[model samples]
Target: MQTSTMRKARYLLLAFSSVILTTGLGGCSVSSILKKGQAEQKISVVPQVLEVNGENVLFEVKAQIPKELIQKKPVYSIDLVYNYGPKMVEPIGKMRFSTGEFIYENDKPTITRQYSFKYTPEKSRGKLLATPHVAKVNKAGKRGKTTEIASGVITTSKLVVKSNTVSLAPDDYRKGVSEPQTLTFFFDEGQAKLRDYLGTNMGVLKELIESNYKTTLVEITAGHSPEDADSKEFRLPLRRAQALEKYYKHELDVKSYTNSSKSVKFRVMPVVRNWDRFLKQVQLSALSPDQINEILTIVNSNVSFKEKERQLAKLDSYEYLQLYVYPTLRYADVRITYEIPQKKDSEIYLLSKKIVENRIDSDKLTEEELRYSATLTPLLSEKLKIYQAAAENTMKWQAFNNLGVTYIQLAQQALKPEIREKLLKEAIINLTYASHRNPTAQLFYNLGSAHHIQGNYLEALRSYDYAIKLGGRVEMLQQVFADKAALEIEIGQLDDAVTSLAYAAPGYQTLMNKALLYTLKGNYQDSKTFYEEALALKPNDALAHYCLAVIAARTNQENDLALHLRKATQLEKNLTAKAIDDPEFRAYVKTPVFREAVK
Candidate 1:
């Protein structure tokens, strides 16, 4: 009975298969296999990757999985990989699909996934390539080999950085009255013509003559040593003075007159005596006190200038006097006076802005204007642009130096390490160029800042020393010393820091920096004094109050400490967190007062 039933079932199954094949072959439709041109696939991304905000690169992938495949419930996975050059030290960023928790809806029948990944460049400016790999999942919940669905090239443009250029103080902006610059020309024993040694002095005089001034007063004073006081020799000194005056009027093209005139004044005074000078030399020498007194008595007596000189020469110390004292006495003193026209504060401010803006024509703006403009602008970016423009326009050392300084400022502001390194290199190039063009104190000072930023402490110190030696504008000098002091403090060179800070101006920031340096050196008393001084300059300074609080806490001044800490926290709320971890308040950390203040 069982065998008969099995044969019947087999016959029935065969009949069923035969009927289905016949129907399918006869053009009946089936939903299991995907038809040609039925499946749709597309990959697209807006913006690729250029101009990505922050670190994220967002892309949308849209596709329509064929309805036939949807019936099979096919699963797909998308993977993204970032190509950063040939080698990547680490992955750029992570990527995430919109959602994969829910099943693909047959009604919807679309494979839509919003893909996102964070991107970071290896350099300041570099290419970033992102490729998306897509694969289908088998029934076993395992992913098959992936095929690159889409790819994009993300580019990063160069990033640069800077601080604002600060304007000069009101007093510094105004030009003060010019004091007379004197140039002395020494003659070689009766020789009145120009000497090889006098060329430098003469050139200086020429420069003064050519400078723009309201008016120039040329005062020539003729002086001769006691030896040349006689009628024949006395006239030679006046003749020599006249010769120099002639050189000034003719060779240097200086406007002047032979005698006292509206612009120039020529004074021919009596020949000067060296008797008093001779007495001083004798006193300083190894000569006995008695001998020196005797020489002075003879020199100071009421005698003719020539007679006094003869008596002084008769002394044992006369040889030293002949070489040192006499040569200095026989010289023509040329005093040139000119008035530096005072500029209004507004004018300087405008000029400085113009220079930084590079709005003024190159032909119209002077080098001084460009240099001063670099110092006066309040915005660092503007300052950098202006210095670059000025350097190109003027091709001067001052412009180059200012440009280097601007680069250093930019480096300070840069967010990326690679970008900062590039900016510092640019600074070094400009600074070296500046030194070659004209090694000004300001140039060395800027170089110092660059070196310091790069961790070249020794080079920074050398540059700072050179800057101080060169002696730039007083304001720049102050800033340079202040910066030097800051470096010294960083290196634990406390005494040097003190010396360096001594040269800085007595400003609020400078005082605060000094206080910090002293505090680092464990001189709480000195630090307290400087912090108080800083507060006097800037009453509402949060940093000043914060530092004072630290000092007060260290010194066991509990009441003052609480007062200042509260004030600091009130002024700047961020200080509360910093104070919580600061070791300076270690003594007070366990106290309720400290906890309350920080909390």
Candidate 2:
């Protein structure tokens, strides 16, 4: 009985030990499953580095979760954030997966997502991170450790040079002005003779020739009355023209004027049987429209000239024509064109200087004269002073507009920020005032430039749009479009920028921006072509060489990359550090060629 009881106790102890061992094994199996799920999770980012498009930073991420993890937890979530500068973070996007929503029959769950966020200067250097969360159904989830998927934002698109279109008001300043004087002499019917009293009419012509001014041309047109019977022979008009020419030579002593250095050119046109002058005089008479049309119809008919005149004389308006028009047609018409002397450029400049200095009355020079004198000198300071005087004295829109444009030009040459800012501010004020007064396309274009330089991008865009809407000269609009395209590229409107650039004039900036657009689109071939064109226009452009180097590195042309990088660094020393930090060159950062070129 004692032996049987000891054997039963041993059996009972063995059964309890087996139960404890089996429970511990199950616990170990559960821990192993969790560890395997954690180890199998995979995340990948395309491009590996974020890039800016238009006005936003964009990127793509693909997450692969193990089936084991999905099976253990009914819900999965991934949170994306862009972290930059001193712990600042921007939540870009989020992705969620649930067991009921997604099927995982025979494959691991994979999710790919694209993310974007508004790009600011602060976010230029930043990293994109992703955090995974696993949760049980109807329970709070546990968050996984955050990992960085992408580093740094590539902002090559922002390198586009800003094009400012400035406009200056035109000036009506001429070196010499032309003054014309007309003299008329009347003769009796059928008489191609000069009247004695008509000699007085030649006084003004002689006075002009005798004066210091030049007589450039003298034209005499002599015609005979259509009623004359000898009009057909056409000798009467010739005789009349000769009579006037003779009187001009003898009575007016025109030969002396022709012999002088300030000589005059004389042309005599004779009108015979031709009814042009008679018809013109008739049209100017007190005749009715019907009478005028009747006369024109008769004159334009396919009949002999005399027959047409006979038909015109048979009309009821014939009496009015003979009394009022025939006398005027039977005379000589003289027109003298002379040049009025003008002040020299130096004299105008001195007068403008005196006006600006308050040494002389502003009224001494006309408003246009003052504006024109500003252009006589190549100095911007002198122009500024002249324009200021014109603006203050006249308060004209042209003066104000020109002054604003000058301010913008000065701002471009200013090296100090404060001075540039002040000049730009003044430009804006003056442009705004001018725009309100005139609202011209040129004024709006100038306003856009002022705003662009001051870093007021939205305002600049608004002004540019206004300038385009209010159409200007073709050249001005082309420049406006180019400038608008540059702004569009900076704001992330790639397609719109392309369209804008189509109408833009081709230049270094325009071509360079086109190259940049192609680079953003991954068309390296087209990008390289445009970059080459732009470099041809401005070979010393360091930024252009650096851009070419970036393309060479991306295409794996190590030799070209080294060559371009060397040139870029030599031209702009600061670009060496830039290339080293650039993500486009990340793949070649440690290579000897890259290191040597940058060095």
TM-score of each: 0.39, 0.53
What would you estimate as the lDDT of candidate 1?
0.57
What C-alpha lDDT, on a 0 to 100 scale, does residue 330 get in candidate 2?
70
Per-residue lDDT of candidate 1, residues 65-84 (tens digit):
43323322323323334444
Candidate 2 lDDT over residue span 497-561, tens digit each: 88778767779988999998898788999999999999999999998899999889879999999
Alpha-carbon runs more than 4 Å astray in model 1: 1-395, 409-421, 452-456, 473-475
| CA lDDT of each prediction against the hidden true structure | 0.57, 0.75
How high is the lDDT of residue 210 in model 1?
A: 52
Worst 10 residues of 1 by lDDT: 155-164
Best by TM-score: 2
